[model samples]
Target: MNLFVVKLSLCFLLFSKITFGQETLEYKLNIGDNLIITQVATQEIVQNMNGSKHEMLNNLECDFNLIVTAKTDSSYVINFSFKRLKIKTMSNIYGELMNVDTSTELKEGNFEAKMFAGLTNSVLKMEMLKTGKIVKITGTEAMIKKMVNKTGIEDEFTKELMFEAIKKEYGNESLSRSFEQMTYCYPEKKVSVGDQWTNNFSGNLIAKNTWTLKEINKSIILSGKSNISMNSQEESYVMKLKGTQETEIIANKKSGFPELITVTSNTQGTSITDQMGKLEIPTTIKSKTIYKTKKYVQ
Candidate 1:
């Protein structure tokens, strides 16, 4: 059922006609709105170390609830919670193979074995401006501890470090990108039905985006391109990384909330370290991510 919706969205994007309204429109969120978002992804990576090849395949799904909890003069306080998560990973290294699968599902009798453990229970309270920018994220150390303990992690230091890492990086890379893709929909000013606007977020990771309003269909379309490049050299080793991504988003015209988002990315990197200094390892990664809003209120 969800897959069918995704395909229909693609067809709509390709065949939808454009219309222009006489007046400018405001596409902003209101108080008391709730958005139920789901993310599904698949990825593959290949690494070449000297003459040996290693490959990994990953599949992941996550569910989130975004609720508007409060309103201010220029911004809104939103509560975001991770409701469920499932992940599967398989790898082949030099002819040896490994696989891992985990899900945070609650069962009648098997609670301990089915929990996602460290992530499905965490919540991030965010302050978002009317223009769709996230200005703050409230911390939740206690929540992280609950997840770590539920997952059977015994080390206190490891749990503490895990919480700190999530606070700094906002969960895994894929999760962070999911929120980033939604926040990128904010336009600076009012726009007509056919007007196009550009928004960008720049830092260690950079993104350039363009958004168009489809007035007749009452949908907003967004397209984006992003890249990252890093290089480091020391007396003992050298490393280099490069990656690029493209994204498409379809959003609700009245509320500026994303309905469907698709992202495709590729990364390639090289690394050499320590006594392995003479050996050069090259890695290539390709990924596809899709986020769909299952239930949304405008």
Candidate 2:
């Protein structure tokens, strides 16, 4: 379920509060406003040489939802914990939040946060309900677990590396695939847009990464890359990272806000390249955020 890993990364990250009673939420983090973690899966297709493949996309896309609450009591800090008990083989997608906000700064205060895992990459994240700067990181469980102090994660594998892991564990046919979860946080990001930052994680996985914020149009976009690989797919699982993803939010007239995020995942791997047949995944990838924000408060 390589698609599951990829979609899990996005779905877990997008599991915000929706107002219309859908999987999304619109509630502001009040003193006790709760957050829900949802993982959405839909039929996935792999680009082929001629066109695309859509054969067994049946119930392959399974989605689950859960509720989470912030444990932090301050507004100027980042904190969260991955409940290892949630899933034995999966991680949260909180590492991606680092890109959502890069200008966070931690003031004098104390903070603690917690993360939970649901089946199918579904997980929840909650920080101290803060009216000040709130950092958000979104990624898989591994990344989410190690990301900043906003999130942290270390990976040395590619999506193809992950594909091979799937082939090894489940045996080819392309039935299931998974990868390390990623997490990042900016408890305090107050640098200018052009400023750069770097961090590292060491544990079951070792990872290093660099990041920069570029203000395009009127939005401050987040861009960065991590050296991820298949360190030990031996008896466990591994994910072949396609590559770095550059993302930006564009304004949606109908939504009255930037509800769309155009993400370009830059990666180069044999399997990914071969999947395209003759075409290429392009040096830059172009994808969209699953959900758009109707309104946001800083």
Candidate 3:
């Protein structure tokens, strides 16, 4: 009888240990929370034109601050503001090198006349879920229009191009899609460490994302793989892009907010255009982007 009692006690302890070890973590939003995120990226692009190769190196940096103003049972209303944007590009075309920087003031050429000087300090409002899904983005179009008007671009052609590009990039549909990709792709149900889920995105490009909860130490780590098929047509060109990307996210386990995120992607594409009369140029692009975040006030 004593032996049977000992065996039963051992079984209870084992069951309790297993249950405690597999406890799930739940994430919810809180008002008055602020997170500042900074992103930096560098890209190497190679294009073949008329049996010759041209290469460009591009660098980009941006900063955003997210402030939660209100929260419901299932969602949060957040205000996102951009503090800075900087882009620098270097290209060697036909043995001549040229550089363009958006943060610098240009004195001559159409670039100077149409430069986006007021792109910084833009703000957008968002309705988002605690699971990192964005339901809607507001005030983006108005902000873009304001920035364009502030440029005071003199040339009509350049002004039109700039306006169109900014609108396409920050407009509601595009911004929503972009924000979706920024998530770690959480599942609908509560998940424990080592859980996995798949996220799909459809837009000008279609990408299949597979994300896994990799680790749970003091912080949580989420890793992902994305397969991309991109196609887009503008007035000047039609581009088809195929690529693969790998992503990693490190989050504060208590708050469920990301502290750092990294993404690396490699793509190859063909651009068909009339720049040289129905020309088809093959291109390759590789980029690595890192985002770091910290707590902020206001």
Candidate 4:
């Protein structure tokens, strides 16, 4: 399920916890603060058209180097570095469609993607990557490639058009369709992980998603996790996901952001056998990240 939403979110890559700089950390993001994004996705999508449940697993490590511009309005120019990118699963693990229990770690390799946008009045510019992530994953990761293409039009449209696409995509109602839903919202008067915020005015966080808010210099930080139930006609499913997330906070002198968080997350999931349980193969996503956001810009 987590993989489902993360993959679903590929259609929409956006950011910030609303109040902008004011997160768990009491301080406001100054010019040097950088916004970091580390995503760990482990999905086991098993569709048995032939009355068989097969699965696979994917473990990838991605990191982004972001420099919060001196001008707050200008979005940070980030160079996305794919660290430890690999594919592993018990089965053939051929296509994006996969089912698995354990994953095989691969040799270390590097890939890259870059995005340039920060606090622009134009939402679209913020939505579209400074470059295209489409071709990058297409041949190697076809399933994800489909997702990138199916949604988020970054074509010849003006900057304004791209943003409009993002808003409309997020606003879609189907986004909430998930099992054991854990949505993240923020209270009106400055809230943190322990605080309560409704979906409507949910700070910068959208509704029906699992959010990880750690304190970066005493401010609420924005991170996310999501679980999605596959399109299964089956009635019963035994699902299990065990993983790890390591977090940190640092004041990056270059960006001025109060924290550089790294979530070294990895998990393995397996569905207990049950005729009534429909959820299929379980998987784990391993991620190692380094993100610096501006909270106290020196």
lDDT of 4: 0.33
lDDT of 3 at 40: 91
Clashes in candidate 1: how many? 1
lDDT for 266 in candidate 1 is 83
Candidate 1 lDDT by residue in tens digits, 186-280: 56665666567776654334556666665435676666666655455655776666888877878776776778988888878886778774677
> Candidate 2, residues 223-297: lDDT per residue as tens digits?
545553323334323223344444343432221223343433333332233333434321222222232333333
Off by over 4 Å in 3: 1-27, 94-115, 154-162, 296-298
Give candidates' CA RMSD values in order.
11.2, 20.9, 3.7, 17.3
Q: What is the lDDT of residue 168 in candidate 2?
A: 38
lDDT-better candidate, 1 vs 4: 1
Sort all candidates by lDDT, best to worst: 3, 1, 4, 2
* Candidate 3 per-residue lDDT over residues 164-268, each given as its tens digit: 887787787788777777753667765567778887877775789888888888988889999998788888888888999999988877777777889899999
Best by lDDT: 3
Candidate number achieving the greatest TM-score relative to the actual structure: 3
> Over 4 Å off in model 2, which ranges?
1-28, 32-189, 200-207, 216-220, 232-243, 249-298
Clash count in backbone of candidate 3:
0
Native RMSD of candidate 2 (Å)? 20.9
lDDT of 4 by residue, 185-281 (tens): 2222454444333222121212333434444443435454433222222224444554444334443323323354443455555554566355455
Model 3 gets an lDDT of 0.76
